[model samples]
Target: MDMWSYFYTCLVSVWLHRLYVYSAVAFGISLWIVIQFTTTRTKRKGKKSHRNPSSPEGTSDKVGNGCAPRQAQEVHVAGVKIFYGSQTGTAKRFAKALAEAVTSLNLPVEVINMGDYDPEDGLAEETSSRNICVFLVATYTEGQPPESAAWFCKWLEEAANDFRVGKSFLQGLRYAVFGLGNSAYVDHYNTAEELFETSSEEEAGGTDSVVDVEDLGNIMGNMKKAKREQELQEGAAGAERREMITPALREALTKQGYKLIGSHSGVKLCRWTKSMLRGRGGCYKHTFYGIESHRCMEATPSLACANKCVFCWRHHTNPVGTEWRWKMDQPELILQEALEKHQNMIRQFKGVSGVKAARLEEALAVKHCALSLVGEPIMYPHINSFVRLLHQHGISTFLVTNAQFPEEIRRLEPVTQLYVSVDASTKESLRRIDRPLFKDFWQRFLDSLKALAEKQQRTVYRLTLVKAWNVDELKAYADLISLGKPDFIEVKGVTYCGESSASSLTMANVPWHGEVVSFVRELARLLPDYGIACEHEHSNCLLLAHSKFQVDGEWRTWIDYGRFQELVREHQRSGGSRTFTAADYTARTPPWALFGARERGFDPLDVRFQRKNKARDISGC
Candidate 1:
């Protein structure tokens, strides 16, 4: 038994040893596998770290994807600097496109935003070389630079005061500026010139920049190309001449937010137009000519005029023509364009909070055309044809002339209302105020007035009174009024817009409504044949009608529109020889429409003065 036990122990020991050896071999195999997996993961991580040199581990590989790392962008220190001061991003985009264009010419170019660039730091040094500096800036609100460029402009303005930067510090600098602005705002494009002049002292020193002025045309062409591309991308139809407007003028008009038509014609939204769009009010003409002021298309047939009146609101930017020297547009084309532009102007108010959709729709179908928009409409070569075209469309025509062209007025067809601007009372004042082109302007003025007196349709003498200028000559004004013998006289105070270099006018020159009332009263006292018929307080205007229109103590100032159209048609049928007079289609004027009778003129909302009681009130009131 003892021998068997010892043998069993030996056997168990041998098996245990073999089992331990087998377990050890299996553990070695597992260890080898674990070691291989760990090595593979470390190799993968090492490869990832090598690929991404920017990793936080700070790897020393200066190459990326088997290529040398990109060097820092080199800036051309002496290259042309294209700086832009943009409000709506147009100027900036233009600057970028210009820089690209210049670079394509193999010239070094650097585009910059004026807002980000420090003008005081190395600007003089950079521009001191043969390098040029180009500024494409836009005029912001009220003739100021964009907010980003305000600091630069202010610095330029105060450069004279800065001891470090002298007035002629930019003397060696070659620079050109392109300003974007509208023509409507006074001093619209005046800021850029002021900035350049102030910084360089060019006006005082009489030393101009050595930069070639020839480059200006190229720069303008590039800007135009950029604008066209942008417009095309935005689905704009054709390249309108309005796009060709000078940067300054375009900026000014754009600043004032005018919807331009073509190059010359403009469609400005008036307060009356806005009021009418909101179903609030109408224009002053609505009371006089029975026109729907809301449905009135305030536009001009010809943007060119012969005269440059000191009191003219257009600021003389419009083309001045002695005759039909310009490319004369056909009457049909003019009418079509004008109507389309008018509709476009009206359409912009769509979806506005206060605008009545129904009234807006009504406004789209223009019922009246005020040709008094900024120019002498009669200067259009086809004036008669234009008038006929307007009438054929059932649109009443109210034409205004500067009284410089007697022949034009004589040949003009009868309109719903014809107005001649009686600028001044005396010949000297007329010469100074009207600033007529004809040397014999006084004779032309007299002849024009005489021709106006013979007109069968409604004739008006519109007198714009500038205090301390022509308001003193009451007898002279009365004499001129007698010459024209107009059916109505509009006495209005001069609206003082701003400082005009063309005229010696100040805010003091503009009269108050009370002052206008006093002047009109004095004038009415001088002319016994005329009576104060109507007043528009908001416009600071008063109307005087001839006594003959006052039938049985009732004023007949309001026009019979239907009867006038009938007479016009009849005259057209009779070959336009059988002319109609103002009395032929006289309509009774409402009492409220008469001056000093009730609450100003024709309050459409006045329940007491409804159309039902208008006739009964006219006889007594």
Candidate 2:
């Protein structure tokens, strides 16, 4: 060909080849798109979606394993309700079907219409009822609850934000949110704030949509943990009849200022708690650890204690046992009951003379939980879960054990502070005073101290010194104190409750404030890395803190509660990968709260009331 003709011919051939290649590529793309469409359509045609989307680990905490079924347990559900809020009738239908399935499982469930329900009036009641309230809500155009459920959403957000309603107003209520709509508004299904998180174990009309009972068991009602415990205790004898607090015992506890929760847990306002509410004084904990006593809830999950100590403030009328053979209550239920009960008791003081409205408002929202009331709190199987519940509510945990459950202490989750009751220094002394049920109590006590030594968080050696019973064993206590290397040592006079069949302890057994001080002074000399830290004069309580808390001559005995909360939340966010020590959240001890202050560790802002009676006077009222 000629040069120009050859070039044009070559260019035309190249253009034709390029066009062919582009056509083939476009054809392949079209074919692939059609194949994908066909496959996706086929997959979507008849297949049902059973699985609820799970936010991966660290996004949010999910409690249950829904992939498998769990065995049933002895614990019975107190209340069951299937709540629905639907624009159409779809969510209501789902609720009815789920309720029917639950009924098939021999569980009686009430179907609720959220539209007619006043959450502010009825929601708080549900918490006290300890019920499993399931929400079946359908999303409308946006990520919002239907008009029927608008009141609930508003109430819930208010419960969280509005201080008047209290931050944890609906705490301890076990409820799951299920979205009736498809995945378009998955993020804002069921409730206004809480995401649609749970699935059903019992299918709705045998569709693919189902939530595993195991997952429901943990987050909903704790059936799985109970079932696991039941399986472990298969051949145990007569667990049903052995309620922790019998009806008669409940009457006694009620009379003694205690409100019983579930079958086992109990909450009572501490005298110190009452005092702080009236602008009187806080407890020794406030002096040593900077805990706000008025806002502290004193509760115990297991009211069946291990000891019938002579000095028990309630005259040791509580049930006594070693292992938890009684019907176990769920931790979430216990938490709910505790908060409500404590708040109700505080509410009773609303019109009382000295109760400041501000303190009353503050006390309604619990800040600290003292698991030191009338029982072995750590003995509860689900103590860790209970602690988590408290922490999740922005409440700090101060769990006190009678040094009887070493393995339990080892297995316990992190707390703001862990206290082991060194009721007596010597083995013989412990046996005489604590009157422990466990035969290997002495070994358990020693092992408990060792476990406390291993804990990353703050550990305390709590000594309830009875003048004639345990005070003379200073050398022995010194040796044990060296072994534990605890962060703080609390020495307080034993509370002398009236005549008890349990023991012959009298007012004579209780030490004077001077005697306690002298004893603490002598004990302090023998111990190293420990010195007198703080004291609550009215409480007759002396605190000895570790040398580490003393930085450049300033005592860091008090806790920065907000910092502690932040650290714990972050630790949980990190999935427990990160560890925090006691020093991390320590705050500087205020001068007035120190041992040698004029007010003697009592907050200066409080008004002192002098009572005439011996019990009231000596007890620092």
Model 1 TM-score, 2 decimals: 0.58
lDDT of 2 at 47: 40
Predicted structure with the largest lDDT when compared to the true one: 2
For candidate 2, report its TM-score. Answer: 0.61
TM-score of each: 0.58, 0.61
What is the Cα-based lDDT of residue 317 in candidate 2?
69
Whole-model lDDT for model 2 versus the true structure?
0.77
Give the least accurate 10-residue stretch of model 1, judged by summed lDDT. 58-67
lDDT for each residue of candidate 2 in 1-621, tens digit (9 for 90 to 100): 599999999899988799887989999999999999999987864342322222111212233454334231222455478888876577888888888867765666899898888877886677666456788776653456677877766556545555565534555455666655432122333334243341121112233333222343234335446766785676465345447777788888888878889888889888888888888888888878888889999999988777656577766667777777778889989999899988898899989997889989999999999998878898899998889989999999999988888899999989999999889988778766776667677898889899999999999998999887888888999999988889999999987777653356788988999999999999999987788989888888999999999999999999999999999998888989998999999999988877777778777777667757623332232
- Which residue ranges in model 1 land beyond 4 Å of their true spot? 1-266, 602-621
Q: Write the per-residue lDDT of candidate 1 for residues 234-339, one digit (tens) a residue.
A: 5555433233245566667656655555555555656687776775556567665556777887777666676767777766666565665344456777678778
